[model samples]
Target: MPNGEERPISYASRSLTKAEVNYAQIEKEALGIVFGVRKFHQYLYERRFTLMTDHKPLVKIFGPKTNLPAMAAVRIHRWSVELCAYQYDIQYKRSEDHGNADMLSRLPDGQEQETEEEKVCFSYINDMPVSAADIAKETKKDQTLSKVLQFTLNGWPSHTEDTRLKPYFQRKEEITVDAGVLQWGIRVIIPATFRKQLLNELHENHLGINKTKAIARSYVYWPNLDDDIEAMIKD
Candidate 1:
């Protein structure tokens, strides 16, 4: 069977989440590659193989030797990091020529259930002072963050006249929503109502400005977050 003919060993598919459904086309394409690789990691791991994608840009972005741009979409960069664990060559195939995968894509089983990994990440949130629901509800109540949530789910505009929304717009590519909570990369985006409370908790130990900022940066984000922490410590 080494005569350049292809054979299918297995198949897998699932519907996208509401958050994933709104991802930019490139992000969705990158997700597909990551999903396929992860779904079949048992077979794919420790072996060399060729990854075929209908998306031409992925061939370059996911190429083994490619250097990802520093400003590339955060999700894409994260996926690229996951891909680095595998040994494979990515190649571009025209959609018309990619019949096997195309047919499977047209027949998704159902909405994806939370993976074990996600359950673990969400479980970590339960141990925090704030819950996901609290963040989500307050995000809706906060006008500026509410707008940022909408932009993250839908698409960000090229420009915004509101200065308050400008910082979020500039980092739009790094923003995402999960379980109703807005996030910048892995950090939760705190709403205005929660910021003061979180600031108090962060400062509780008197870890001082630098240590508090480091801890806060690990778990939360808001515009001028560092400045806010600095001012709180100074006052």
Candidate 2:
């Protein structure tokens, strides 16, 4: 169509899987466009094209520099990276002007069925079910972890040779607290997000409860951590 011919090049449409259906409208739209490019990479890769969508926020996101808001999840960040493989201009089109895409979006498809093996491989239960708010609250109660959380969120103080939190200071840049959730690199701080999952990993391997407690102590700390690990293993 770059040559001005009315003829089309490629077309594709498919119902999103269950996980995708739960995405916000902006995420869904961005995914659809990204999927389209991937599906037609032979035609789209290295070639300039215009990706029209009804979501205006997508325009800003795909721009050269993006100040992703706090509400933007890591999922959005991943999707943005996936979109970088192509050269395209994201333009907003009115819903009325968006024709076939609107109809395809409404086309119903059956839910995806997952096998038993899939279930075993993917347990949705999070190990640490703690929220950012809970992390903040807990930090206020514990002087040590609170200092660690604050140091991770804000900048750590200079000169900490005598401090017990020397290890944290050494790796301060890699550790961060975003949206009240402390993260050590990509792995969330186990205090709240993946506590249960980590415990299960230890228990499933029959790593003795004491060993698990030792492992937790080396990297992280919270009140009753040993008790929590023991309970998870018992379950």
TM match of model 2 to true structure:
0.45
lDDT per residue (tens digit) for residues 1-235 in model 1 = 5997777777888888756765655677788889899989999999998999987768888999999766555668878999999999988889788655546656787787655544554565675788898988989989898888777766667689999999888776656666668776678888999888999888888999999999998788888899999999999
Deviation (Å) of 144 in candidate 1: 1.5
For each candidate, the alpha-carbon lDDT, in order, equals 0.80, 0.59
Q: Which ten residues in a row have the lowest lDDT in candidate 2?
A: 117-126
Model 2 clash pairs? 127-194, 127-195, 127-196, 127-197, 128-192, 128-193, 128-194, 128-195
lDDT per residue (tens digit) for residues 74-165 in model 2 = 55676678877778887888978655444444554444453353233212223344444565565556555567766654446765874656
Best by TM-score: 1
Query: What is the Å distance of residue 21 in model 2 from its true position?
Result: 1.5
Worst 10 contiguous positions by lDDT, candidate 1: 114-123
TM-scores vs. true structure, each candidate: 0.68, 0.45
Q: Scored by Cα lDDT, where does model 1 land?
A: 0.80
